[model samples]
Target: MRRPGSVRTLLSCLSATSLSVGLMALGGGAALAAPDTPPAAAKPMPAQVVAPYFETWTGQSPAELAAASGNKYLTLAFLQTAVPGSCTAYWDGETGRPISKDTFGRDIAQMQARGGNAVPSFGGWSADTTGTELADSCTDVDAIAAVFKSLVTTYGITRIDLDIEGDSIDNAAGIDRRNKAIAKVERWAERTGHSVQFSYTLPTSTTGLQANGLAVLRNAVDNGARVDVVNLMTFDYYDGAPHDMAADTATAAAGLHDQLAALYPKKSSTRLWNMIGVIEMPGIDDYGPEETFTTEDAVTVGKWAAAKGINTLSFWALQRDNGGCVGTGGSDSCSGIAQDTWYFSHTFEALTAPHHPHH
Candidate 1:
């Protein structure tokens, strides 16, 4: 389910499987060049942060909206190459929008100044299905790793979210390469004393992650990729049935907790719960009238997520937290149900407290 502004900058994604031929030299850009200026000391996100997806393609400043919506941290969405087979990634796949302080540097810094940081997310639905995703289009593991390192140096962000969906979930070769790059990045982070965490945002069935989604994480574990979080997009079930949106959110997360337990049996129940994240499709999702999340659901889930101590509680997007378009499904601008603007943000952002003491 591609977002409204997804198709504006897309190119055919040719499968370029050169495979892990060891570490390859980074392509042009600061991927290999030393930073023009020294990066300041980093301010990592809180262990429990509510970072809703911020749509970069909408020509809106994430910092401006975060301030208006009372959200400090935002997960900037969809960084990939404009063209497939290109190792170099750009925000929203825009060639002119390469990573630099001139781009989102000022805004990201402002968020950090306020005790929050922007976590850049890569590979949205359009990129995943089209093969423009960094790991899918570019087969060079080293180049992929280099780009990730640059994000840390340029923005001082502590976490990266990988929103793998559709075709990319089943890409065995891409999964292997991505996990290899993650291992490399982790090693680099350890040496440089940077706290970098990777979260995989995968689509889930009502029960749990389907087979393809599981395969992605399995490869990560096999390749020694430290998965700090497993975020599930709990919207857009598309089963064409009326749903108890809030209850379904609970069941879906519970199923994921079981899956995480199976994946890492050594971890305790609290740790497995902490490793989880859920994205609610506020208002109506892409499945028309079959799926809807209400304002009451937001309040309920916020309290539930904090009590359960889930690492993250986010929505499909920050921009869609309003009631501008009633009965709409998947509108990029507003939530399709009746509610005040920024209602969801106001409800969920409080969970960022490092210690969310339960009542």
Candidate 2:
């Protein structure tokens, strides 16, 4: 389920329990004493990266989706974070107290069997177990970093995403803690010779990333973290309708480009663009009919992202990539708009060149 409003709006309503550990910290970046060091070059991706959001706990299993699509989609992002009290990542609503590798091992194996990859996402709207919350609960930052490393190594995935939002995004203390822990995680990867990539999934307004959103990026560099990509949830703009969904998303992405230019002054303009991404909620959004992201909108955004050489292109979910629930209000089961199954996915996939690798 989506939040009642944009993350910024929800920040004010959190209580002490939640505030003790939050995720969104919109404060201006604290000036660091050390001169900024050029961030390590993000690991090279295929000619074009087209990874779609795969809701592992939703409509169908990763293998099922991949089979049905005839392996047209090779990379899928599994939705979610692990349990809150422990470092283990598990599917939301499962009864297991301490989740283990078996929790999702079968599904992971199934996807990999079909030549597909899973990007483990931390934190989403439907769960209380956020990435920051998971990190805050840990006594040792290394332990938290270990959890991330273990998961990455276990799953054979080269990339991971931190979707910080809602109460999780508002917690300044939690934000710092999470950044530090992730920095350590990157360090571990470097020292162990484990190649890994990191991306942050954040909310945004039409103009660009909100104050706290910007802080999340700055803090990464300030804490000596390597962020491969800054992904924007380019949907639900303040929970209202926008004049043009595609244009609004592109404008916000452009705004982010300028912000990154300042954050990494030495990086070339093209490299900065490659360090950015856009994640959209196709079709009718939870906000209501006022905002409709049509298949055409996907094409528009795809073309712009491709032309701009953006690092990644994905959407809110693959479960809703069908037209079964058109105009049925917001639904996790479908995009709530009329469209053939896999149409939206195919549209976005077209953004990449034909030679780009796909399983």
Please name the candidate that would achieve the greatest TM-score relative to the true structure.
1
Instruction: List model 2 lDDT by residue over 1-359, tens digit each.
Output: 23445532111122112322221222221222121221122133453576776654432456567566543333333233344555544444233312234445455556555555566666655442344245444556666677677655555556777777766666666677678888887887767666677888888877778888898888888999888998888877755445588998889899999999999999999899999888877788767777678988887887787788898887766767889998964565588888989887777776665653332
CA error at residue 127 for candidate 2, angstroms: 3.7
Error of 2 at 90 (Å): 2.3
Per-prediction TM-score to the true structure, in the order listed: 0.89, 0.80
- Candidate 1 weakest lDDT stretch, 10 residues: 9-18
- List runs of model 2 lying over 4 Å from the truth: 1-4, 7-47, 70-85, 93-101, 113-115, 128-132, 355-359
lDDT of 1: 0.79
The pairs that clash in candidate 2 are 22-171, 23-168, 23-169, 23-171, 24-168, 24-169, 24-170, 26-212, 82-89
* Residue 271 displacement in candidate 2 (angstroms): 0.6
**What are the clash counts of all predictions, listed in order?**
0, 9
What is the C-alpha lDDT profile of model 1 across 1-359, one tens digit per residue?
33222212111111212111221222222222244322454665566889988877666777789899988889997788878899999877776678777667777877877778899998877788778999999999999999998899888888999988767777889999999999999988887778789999987777778788888888888999999999988777766678888888889889989988988999999999999999887888766667788888888888889888899888878888899999887777788998999999988876765555676
Q: Rate the local accuracy (lDDT) of all candidates.
A: 0.79, 0.64
Instruction: Compare the candidates by lDDT and give the number of the best one.
Output: 1
